[model samples]
Target: MGNQPSVPQPGTPLQVIGAGLSRTGTASFSEALRILLHGPVYHGGTQLTLAASSEIRPLMDIVSRFPPQNASEKKLIGNLLKQRLDGYAAVTDAPFNGLIEELVEAYPNAMVICTTRDAESWVKSMKSIQNAVTMGFLRFILFPIPGMRHFPDFVDLMRKQWWYLYEAGEPLVAETYYKHIDYLKRVVPEDRLAFVDVKGGWGPLCKALGKEVPRDVEFPRINDSQAIDRLAKRMVQEGLKRWSIGFATVGVVLMSYVFWK
Candidate 1:
């Protein structure tokens, strides 16, 4: 199929497209972008996890059709994501990392930055996040909530995007990273593509985006493992709280039924 809508939809404001996976210092990079862009950014996985019920449902359907099979499929995915991302300055992190090519082509002018870290270190961090996700099972915990019933589909979407790494193991995870890097190098033009290893601090990123390095602001170093764990715990608490409300409502209904009976 032809490139996925190379021209941005009319009046679209997105200026950056991130083709980086989680644990590639993506959290820190995202925070940095927030500082630089002075606008909202569509952070990939986290947004999907916490999106409104109305949004989560459509997002689930869209993501489940990954690796778009045809040009039309590509447009469908691109148009929907663009609609969601229209107002944002940029997007970074998981699932979207899998859509790097499409996004690169979709918004030809957007700066494409691939967040990078030492491969071994990145894979180790990735495994920790994977454990947090799998053992914690955020989807299962939240499934009972009417609003979050489609959570499993979101998980499935991530799984499909990272099938090579998730289904296999670390060796493949490292391999996948390199392969992605190679893809970026091959497909993305030199002028627009930037590789930011956040550990190196803000200089590299600042220079890439044509923004002077901020002497006052300390570069963010968000440990995603800790962040993800906290998120899972919060979601679990929310789920249980919702279940309690549902039970209380049912109890009230049952009491009324008995009284009327």
Candidate 2:
């Protein structure tokens, strides 16, 4: 926990909770949910880019500190959700996957959507997107400087939540993925939960949400490997630029001091 606050800021209650793992069309589902619900939908991208700075520590603390088995942690979990996730109508990916139990407790009436793809496909996608992104960040940003290993805020959160926690390799990845799905199945009520594949498109999702399928719009398919790789490269370039600027500033300061002396 970076900074522990006693209470979180109030926010609107959530209406939908996505219990899906990454590479399971979470981005597409987030887009669709935003459109259908006519409100903000939190995704991994949202976690990285949009969430308030104060919220991040509590999120990390809650996930790492409070295992569901501990009865005392429930209140802390509720407080964390209310503080961090109150206004979002829906939440998916990264941090949210690890908080399903707490989310369901906080929003008992909200629908749960568990997106699935074949495990083989999911693993393949993860290798391309997740691994590539992490490696790019490491190679171009952190590895160059021994003391500068901490990532930028969003990437740091992701590193803690995803990569650091589950870096054992493919077997662990598969285990965590299936374990998440199984946990949702066990915890959420049948009526409140919907298991779907992105390929099922609007039919299953719409039916689950009790809304009519949109007449003409095709379902969204986003965050392919190419796009993710491009983002990774952009991040690397940006980090390198920042590092260069810092070095230049330091050199200028040192030269100015020597001249004055």
Q: Can you give the TM-score per candidate against the true fold?
A: 0.83, 0.80
Each candidate structure's count of clashing pairs: 0, 0
Q: Write model 2 residue lDDT over 1-261, tens digit each, in one string.
A: 001112212454578899888778888888787667767676754454233444455555666654545766776777777666666778887677767777888888899999899876787677765565456446458433332333344444555555433443432356667766777887788889888887888899898899888878888877545556665566567668878988899999999999999
Tens digits of per-residue lDDT for model 1 on 1-261? 000112123454778888876778777787787778776667766565555556566666667777788999988888877776777788887677777767877787899999888877777877766665565566767877665667666766667767643354433457777877877887788889988888889899988899988768999877677767776677788888888888899999999999999
Q: After superposition, how far is residue 145 of candidate 1 from its true place, in Å?
A: 3.9
- Give residue 140's lDDT in candidate 1 (0 to 100): 62
Q: lDDT value for candidate 2?
A: 0.67
- Candidate 1 stretches with Cα past 4 Å from truth are 1-12, 136-138, 164-172, 255-260
Q: Which structure among the candidates has the greatest TM-score?
A: 1
RMSD of each: 5.7, 5.8
